[model samples]
Target chain A: MTPKISQFLSQKNPSTPCLVVDIDEVELRYRAMQAALPAARIYYAVKANPARPLLDRLVFLGSCFDAASWEEVDLCLSAGARPENISFGNTVKKVSAIKAAYDAGVRLFVFDCVEELEKLARFAPGSRVYCRLLVNNHGAEWPLSRKFGTTPESARTLMLRARELGLDPYGISFHVGSQQLSADAYEVAIAQAGSLLADLAADGLRLRMVNLGGGFPIQYRDDVPGIAHFGQVISRAMKIHFGETLPEILVEPGRFIVGSAGVVSTEVVLVSQRGRDEGPRWVYLDIGRFGGLAETEGEAIRYMIRTARDGEEVSSVALAGPTCDGADILYEKSCYTLPVTLEAGDRVEILATGAYVSTYCSTRFNGFAPLAEHYI
Target chain B: MTPKISQFLSQKNPSTPCLVVDIDEVELRYRAMQAALPAARIYYAVKANPARPLLDRLVFLGSCFDAASWEEVDLCLSAGARPENISFGNTVKKVSAIKAAYDAGVRLFVFDCVEELEKLARFAPGSRVYCRLLVNNHGAEWPLSRKFGTTPESARTLMLRARELGLDPYGISFHVGSQQLSADAYEVAIAQAGSLLADLAADGLRLRMVNLGGGFPIQYRDDVPGIAHFGQVISRAMKIHFGETLPEILVEPGRFIVGSAGVVSTEVVLVSQRGRDEGPRWVYLDIGRFGGLAETEGEAIRYMIRTARDGEEVSSVALAGPTCDGADILYEKSCYTLPVTLEAGDRVEILATGAYVSTYCSTRFNGFAPLAEHYI
Candidate 1:
């Protein structure tokens, strides 16, 4: 725990668990992504902690929206995002939810099967649809093929059926899984989507868009590629597939939007012996699995936990939550040393996990406190 | 997916990620526990769901309250529980929370260290303190030796300090851990608490209560011991040590009380082939890791998932969550099969997990719907 962190919380507000978003960082990243892909469409996946202020800012920056549920759709609409720009992309949606989206004028719906397509057609025929195709493993770092995606053998058949039903099948989309490390997988998925569209050309269907789904690695971990390098690969794949005239590129990047700009600020509750042995003591922090820090498998997302004010250092201590459960630990082990006198009530901030944090947290385990989101 | 399940959901409500409490089953279990442990005092741990209706029933049944936070304290007080009957038993508590409990006339608080005790004294001076002792390995199936609790030497020192500070320390408590399969762990923990209290007596501190904390197991899994069988071992230990008279036996039962009675009803959206060359097929359910079905170290909590209306024949199928992530599988290989002929839009109820289900769920992964809770 950092001494400056305690002083900072005392100075502002003494809330236990709160998400602090660096607005400048988010703006910079969004601007960078916009600059790189000028013609490509960017849909901000709002499932990643849909703070209203963040949403309002994203809309102000002229970004389109990709909503998963009617609630997210409502949130975007309330924030003044155009309904036509909002694409409802979850695989399994309730009938009422489908009707609600259609009634709200959301035209682009992602479909993986004939069942979903039929359901959409019955509820909202003439709506624009995107047929999601499942790309086979072309040596990707994790076989995320288990998730929702129509396989190659069935994609052509599904597209033909959509055409027969008089629904405007606007595009094809496939993600190489989130946190994808290799450019090869993206290239293969794009090639696969292009080949499927080409195969369906005998039906006289003109593919207006091809979405090589966003798994462009952000290099949070050691082995993932940088965004700029991955951009070059995407550009190359688009040129190779479309023969000098590419369709519009649509990418949904949830983590890449605000994941690195957010930190869960917490306070130290206790520092005690981890065991009876003469080993390192564990420093219990206010945040736990309850605070969305549990996303990492038994390890906390790396954040610079130190004095929030003067940046005074503190000794390395094992971070533990207040929950009685043993698995409620935040960090596997302490990595950094501190300089200040840290004790009970000292504050610590967990970093780089803004996406899919707090708003997607389980606030009911052993009474862990929720973080107050402060946009920087 | 069971055939009967699909029929029910298509006919009835088909919502994704909803929790339902079997009130009849809960009442039966509550009565059975009350009958078995007539001599002991029972306190329902509010950390588990804390349903208002359930708490009301427990209050009417006359169980003392166990509160872990100010929110729980507020809930109990609002539910008309006398502050005297409620024990604020969390080891690490905020100063404001302690002060709030003190203002509410809460008298007893549990402390795990000298620092916590000191914090309690500063806020709620002259209140009786219960020092939590570290239970040595008593062979509990899942020993909770870590997190809270001090060593014997440190506990003794803390007790001596409490006396010096002109404060009264009344008791010792030790939780063996949750879901204990072996009864021997309770004996060992009680013996351990007794030995420490005996040593404290030698130091001239009069200890009134010895809370051999609750870890009585429930049969979520087959191998876990039955409540009655585990109760025998606990009662026998109390008789052997205290000899027909003992400090109030406060057993904190959350999962044992409401776990079996609670069920989550989810809609089966898609039935997909798991792997080629015959791996198996999966019925993707609406709930995921964020829903109370989060697996502990990749093993989901054991539950009997079945259809509500029909006694249809069952078949094996893996239940996957709606999240795009591969880790969101509820159960990779379900032990028991549900009724057959389950297809898209079927409802499956996962039983015996009411305790932690709704309190720890998120509906926004991959833009999924929010978790809705209903208590009957």
Candidate 2:
């Protein structure tokens, strides 16, 4: 446990619960992804735990930033990301956020629905925009295909409206749902996106970019494809669908970029027996659903967890938080043996929580503050 | 809508999201429970959203404070609860916390494990200690039995140990579970607690109090029993099982006291249609699982949502939040007919979130700040 956690702890003060970033691992992945897709631009989703150190590293790797809110826009700006390189893709933007992002130099934004497009038309004149297509290509059944993305018909209308308003509609973007495990989903989404772009071009609309919205699968489970392979498949599909003339490609790889770069270190507060005979015992930890790990609810995502001291392996024990609520249990059920009994004051290291975890969760229950983040 | 929200919002800053508390609702429940258990004392669990206004209201209702941590103890003390009226009952006491609570003038505490008792004995001598009994009297299905409550056999040993250390072992307590829906569970737990108290008394240990523990169910779901009837059941069990000759009885009610009195108000950001032909449509709100309402997960609890404004009623639509993650959907599949089209900038009130909502949670994700709180 200690060996696994040594890199995460402050050599001076190791006991404090916090989020540690594996900068080396992050840089290695960044370099690999960059090497694989040298022509494609990578927009680091700033919503995935925007610590300054991580932002700095992404900048060093030539990765742009994807911001959701004005605050995120300001964060990327502070991290020295050029506004021209940042994409404000929250879709549902407040007028103030729109102005702020534009003023902060963000050139590209996403237009999902007509209302959002109208808002953009009224507030952001002459801004480069990406009309999001609902790639209902029967991709991953995930994300339920029902939020921001407008239908291809609606996307056509939005693109025409953008042209009518003299807005620079530079490209089309579509998310095939997050944590999408199917490789065919990308192939189908890319085909749909390619068709939409061709239709818009046929309708006299020119495009210079196509944002294949990021849903590149991260290995939360071994059954999922590896990130490198996912990149290769997507690149190949883009070439196959649109050929060599495909617009300058952009991938908003949020989870794949930072998901494996961070680990949350929490203490085991209590361990209790569950089923006396046939059931597995449970060990209550200091983290739960609110511990920046909302992706597990149905994302088909799982995290690597281990003891934080002495390099011990923990056995299969259900984990729950201190919340009296039953749903506070973290894992469904799994088994592993630890080097030692996780007594009071023992810490557990949860891996791959860097991405959608803390960035999308809150400490709105049990009074546990969000873990302080540190980049290695 | 503005008119309805006016009662729970700041007149100067009306648009900010917030949790609103109705003091009267909390007070009425506290009084109803108090009147039913004439012989039983009341310790309001402050960990269940210890809002200052709520604590002040509970104090006005003549309820003692039950603090689970040093932060809660400090909150109670600062709220003007007399030191003698505060009981520090967290079983796993940090050494510093034990010394701190004792120094803060809290004389009553619950000791569950012998190790904790010994630590408290070494640090806080002559304190009025309560032995927490591991009464697995909850329904057979509730498998989290080994967490708290020292068993009767071990509790007796702990009581003797405390007495040997010159600590006043004045009471016995048992926690059934949180939001316990079963009236029989409380009755059985009380009966078992009575037997334990009687046995301790027979062993020449005088009992000054008996805590029936907090499992007082709140009406989160349609099938949950109302607090008024549940209070009567618990009051009757204590009176019948302990014969009214019991020590100054105590019951800690966390969820029941404030669950109905509070609601989280957030604005609608977007609405999206999910699935096709036969799928559900979702209205995206600004709140989610990490947004102080734990109702989004598998927790049996449900939030009764309504439009903040009174006007035309619209069709029921599924609700989600601003997070890009799939788990950000608020309603699993529940439909809510609102007073208006929940467009951007419209507020929706998520009711029954007062208990174990904000205090147990913090706004740490996505760099979102916790909603400001208000008291009505």
Candidate 3:
């Protein structure tokens, strides 16, 4: 356990199945990222954990925001972020949402297709727009599919079309992928961005900004490089490609900023053997995939878990959420070992779950309330 | 397209990404179940779409309810269901929820362990309790894991303990599985329950009820036996095992009551080709895994999909959700073929989605609203 978690648990006793975010850890992460990549502006992605408190804290720290829609832009603005500092990062958006964001004073937007570019030109004319370039995301733990970006050839046409349609062809952007593990992924993506920049420059279009989309990995169960290493790798790539004439560099880091700053405390509802006397024991918790941890879909992402009865004799158990639905089972194939003495009411803490939890929680399922959240 | 969906679309134009429940279909299904299983009591499971309109309609039809939580009990009561007609079906429940249900005059409750029985003994003394027996769910389309219920030995002990603890050990219940396909599954489960019932009878305890828990399959993308066939199979099993003396038979049907009654209308957000030029076409929709179709997790349950341009030239396409998350991709391996000319803003109707779609919807993810529900 990290000292931050130990300190928070020592001071506070929250209700079971509650998410407790350590604000101090958020501050530490933000400062570390800032120190590592001083030349890059950080636009905190609000979708990770859009709790008002975290947004307010980030705003107080003078952090820019990467808003996905009009609602997110409103969330940031309500948290006191300057509208100019918020970028509409989603490439596929409804025309009404585009108008809503433009009306709310959001000037920077992202687009990947001619349809989106046309929507932008009509809804938010003369707004600064960035074209997203398609890149390989094989190494990312959460490998993003070909969902958001366009090919290099298609991006060129879109950028040129943006200028013709009375929208500023601001720059280019690419997401390595969420929970990207290696700095080499950034090197490859940065090199791709560099080539796109050169190609666009050859067409006599001088782009003013480049968005290195959110994908910075955080330490969970696996080892990951620190923010400084990512910064060094990114800085080296930019220098080799763009030299000293680098455009205004912006980085969106959602997980790295808040992933480690939060911890979820849940209680064991039941621990029972299913089949025969010697069959595997199933441990049920008040929280599950629908409760807040939707990322556990297919058990792709594993959160580092700790029990109050740690250091005791342990056995592997299948973990499940407290719901009548059979699909609520959390970790069945990828089972976790808990203290043999663990029983009902025993607490378990899931670490580094601040991001993608609360936002993904359903309103109510099987009479269980949504996961409550607390910030320290 | 199903005639129900076609008529709905032809008569009324609901907004995109909306759930349209045909109340007429619900009435037909309810009446069919009543005609098929006249000897068994039907308790509509409220967890599967607890929309007030449906509850009120079910109440008008003199339907009993199988409530999962206190909130569901309240919904049933508000829908004009008598307290005695409601059964607290979920085995895993919070103590507070149990107390709330008891206070609301709910008498019947289900449990599978000593812990839950004790909770009932404290909160709902003298209340009738049913013990759930473990059963195999091997061939179910949505096969339930070992999430609920206990072994026969444990259940026997629990029932006796319930009698000793001032709680009424009323009956036994078992769920074959959700979307249970085979009649043989029910036959085997009924045999297990009958043996347990006979053993408990030999112990001088008279149990008065047997809950054949809900798993009646509905037609979606494949053929399933009607409610009459399930009733025949169950009746045959009961006659073979229990002979003349039979307990009060009760069935809790959630999906069967509402599954075929609803259709979801969604707009195609984008249709683009990914990877190589010959690769599969990717079709994105306004709704996705988080948007309410969570049962599609692992593509276990396939909803019948139809487009407005259904008769046009068809080609296979990979379907996805509108969310920015990579895991939002809906069907890749089990791909759907749609009109080759399908484009953004075209409508698609997902049939037989009325049961598990609305209540499971999250409030917002990526700033997209939860699925809008409409009853016709």
Top candidate, metric DockQ: 3
- Candidate 3 per-residue lDDT, tens place, B1-376, comes to 3476677777888777899887778888899988888888999989888888998899999999999888889889988999999999988777768889999899999988787788889989999999988889977877765678888998888889999999989999999999998988999999999999999999988788889988899987878887789889999999887889889999999899899999889988767663236767888888888888888877878888887788999888888887777777778778678899998778888889999888777767776677888887
Clashing pairs in 3: none
Which prediction has the highest lDDT against the true structure?
A: 3
- The sequence of per-residue lDDT tens digits that candidate 2 reaches over residues B1-376 is 1243346454544454577777888887788777766766789988787888888877776789888767678888888888899888766555666788888898998877666677778778899999877666454222334555656777777888899988889888878777677878878877877887788889998778888777776655455776667668877887887785757878888877887777777777665442133444557676665556555555345667666465676666666666554545566455555554557667677777777777534354544566667777
Q: Which of the predicted structures, 2 or 3, would earn the higher TM-score when compared with the native?
A: 3
Q: Chain B, TM-score, each prediction? A: 0.88, 0.88, 0.97
CA error at residue B101 for candidate 1, angstroms:
1.7
TM-score of each: 0.87, 0.85, 0.92
Once superposed on the true structure, which residue ranges of model 3 sit more than 4 Å away at CA? A1-15, A164-166, A203-208, B1-14, B164-166, B202-206, B274-276
lDDT for each residue of candidate 1 in A1-376, tens digit (9 for 90 to 100) = 2233334445777476787676566777788777766658898878765777888888888888878777788889999899988988776677777899899989888888777788888887898888888776444433456666777657777777887887887889887876677778888888888887787776687778887666554434344566777778788888898777788889887777787777677777776653256644577777676656655544523445545433565555666777666667766463645444677777666656677776666656666545567775
Q: Give the share of true interchain contacts found in each model.
A: 0.35, 0.19, 0.44
Candidate 1: residue B135 lDDT (0-100): 73
- Model 3 agreement with the true structure over A1-376: per-residue lDDT tens digits: 4576677676776777888888778888889889999998999988887888888889989999998778889999998999899999987676777889899899999988776787889989999999988888977878774666878888887888899999999999998888888889889888888888888899988888889988898877678888889899999999998888998899998888899999888888777765357756888888888888888777867788898788999988888888888778788787678898998777889889988888788867775667888887
